[model samples]
Target: MPDSGLEGLLRELSPQVLGALVRRYGHFDLAEDATQEALLAAAAQWPGEGLPDNPRAWLITVASRRLTDLLRAEQARRRREDTVVQWTLPEEHLAPAADRLAADSDDTLILLFLCCHPSLSPASQIALTLRAVGGLTTAEIARAFLVPESTMTRRISRAKTGIKTSGVPFGMPPEADRAARLDAVLHVLYLIFNEGYASTSGPDLVRSELSAEAIRLARIVHRLLPDDSEVTGLLALMLLTDARRPARTAPDGTPVPMSEQDRSRWNSEYIAEGVALLSEALPHGPTGQFQIQAAIAALHDEAPRAEETDWPQIEALYELLLRLSDNPVVSLNHAVAVGMARGAREGLAALEKLDDRISGDHRFHAARAHLLEMAGEGAEAVESYVEAARRATGLPHQRYLHGRAARLRES
Candidate 1:
């Protein structure tokens, strides 16, 4: 294989290989180091020898060897108890095809659990998971959080140190602790998808890469815990939302409201999958926030035209969501449905009640602006759009707000 192809293969295979390595070594730091060394070895060898049939397996073998060498060297230097023995592959385990899929799946889940270790702050867990598990660059993670690259780097480093010092186990948490940790894991995955669905601060309106990563994570979580209703709901929500990605932006990267977006452009396959998942999730007795949100998205997807939308059903779903999760965001979203179902004035009134609670959120202002525009309060609408644009973090969103305000001003 050519050098470029080999490099590409290495990049693609690194995550799985590293996950396995971490499982073997019982430390993220060691897994990362060993994976890097394996890549270097591959760079020197694969070009001359050709790509291996099983690239991931090949990388795992090389990384395992590299880890053993490092541990032996460390033991000699410190005269300390040898930790390398733990990483040594047994002769019985040498064949990569043997339990490869099962091992990889377990490793990936374990890596996620490690990233969500309770000792680190939630922000650090998200930042680290985005960087490590999602394979996002530090710059991308930093942009998502509106932080400096250096600061994100420090946060990731601290997170790694925290994991090491806290002696957090690498594999899946026990059944008792799984419920408690599930929220953090789900929240991290949600944030990843949201960043991908609508980039917070980049030139592009949609970061498909990030969105794809999030969807992949959600699917993995669903597979790992198939009976977990919230996991199923999250998968359904993401699929439903992702189905409309093609119609969510203009060719120029401007925002396209759902009412104006072309339904024909939406991915029917994803919509079907989302609908099926939602059906499966609904029978689980009680619904969670994700399930309610998925129901709302499904309501929109089921409509052939904007006027045909079941606004009352959507309003009811949002109301249920608000009940399940008393978040200001939920209330604000519910207000949009109320406005569409009842009238702009009703929506405006509902939004106004949320002002004191969600004044700092730009979306709250943007929603109010849209409602006011529909209400013919052009001046107030323009002011609200201006405020939303001022507080907006992403370039595309800010531009969209400005354009909306400018159009209203001209009218």
Candidate 2:
């Protein structure tokens, strides 16, 4: 197999391998490290040797051996230091042979639940989920977040340590807590996708790798929980939103607002998939925020052109979303939809209601600026645009806001 194909195969299997090791061995940090080593070995050897008949089992076997070695080494170190380790390794005789590990037993979802443990911060949760479940290298995750590789390494290390200290078992959370835990998992994925789609603080408008990883992870969750309306909705939302990526930027990387983008460039496949998923999700139960958001995205995706966007429906969906979560960002977006569906003044009125909550946010200023422009208040619009530019952290966002101000000044 080619290196790329081999690489993808290894990434897909690495988490399963790690999940199996951790589930049996009860050492997450070591098991994760061992899984990475196993992946490295596969990368080195798989190109020379043909793919294994059971590639997942092959990785699990390799990783389990590596984990055992690591565990014994740690035990020896504790012995030398005259300090007893708190946990004892399970009897080797009782453990199942790696090659004979049950093919039907997958702990990947459990692994994801562990990575999103409540003890970890949101940033750490995102980093750890990408590492453990998404099978990304630490350096690759670092580059995606635009952090130094060393910093990312530390974040992941700390996240692992946090999980260990929390003493969370290597299984699903209690049935009582499972729903909340799943929400955390979904939230982490949502954050990852949002960062990729619209980087909070970066030179680039979109980090395709991060977004793609988020989508990949979302698909995994959706597959695992096919009946989960929110899971399906989240996946649908990502697909619908990412469908615009092809037309999101210009040759020079300047972001083209959706209204100005050429609709023909959007990914129809993503749109169709997203629409289908949303259709399947909406009627299942009471609508959640993700489903509502997906419904709004489907409206945008189904539109033939920007001019045909169902803004009234989108505004209604946003309103539904706001009732579910008191998110100022949602309110800001709601203001935009109001402006589009009703009028600039009405949108401005809606935005004003969020002043107390998100007045300082660059998004608020940016939206206000746009509405001001639409209201024929170019001077105020230019001021708001300049403020937004000043407050914006991402270079692309800054450039866009400044350019808006400059255009209005010239006009």
lDDT of 2 by residue, 334-385 (tens): 9999999999999999888885778998989999999999999999999999
- The C-alpha lDDT values of all candidates are 0.82, 0.88
Kindly report which residue stretches of model 1 are placed more than 4 angstroms away from their true locations once superposed.
1-16, 39-57, 76-105, 136-150
* Candidate 1, 168-252: lDDT as tens digits: 7666778799777887788888987887898777677888877887898788778878888999999999999999999999888
Looking at model 2, residue 225 earns an lDDT score of: 90
- Root-mean-square deviation of Cα positions for candidate 2 versus the true structure, in angstroms: 1.7
Cα deviation of 283 in candidate 2 (Å)? Answer: 1.3
Each candidate's number of clashing pairs is 0, 0
Q: Could you tell me the lDDT of residue 362 within candidate 1?
A: 89
Q: Candidate 1 overall Cα lDDT vs. reference?
A: 0.82
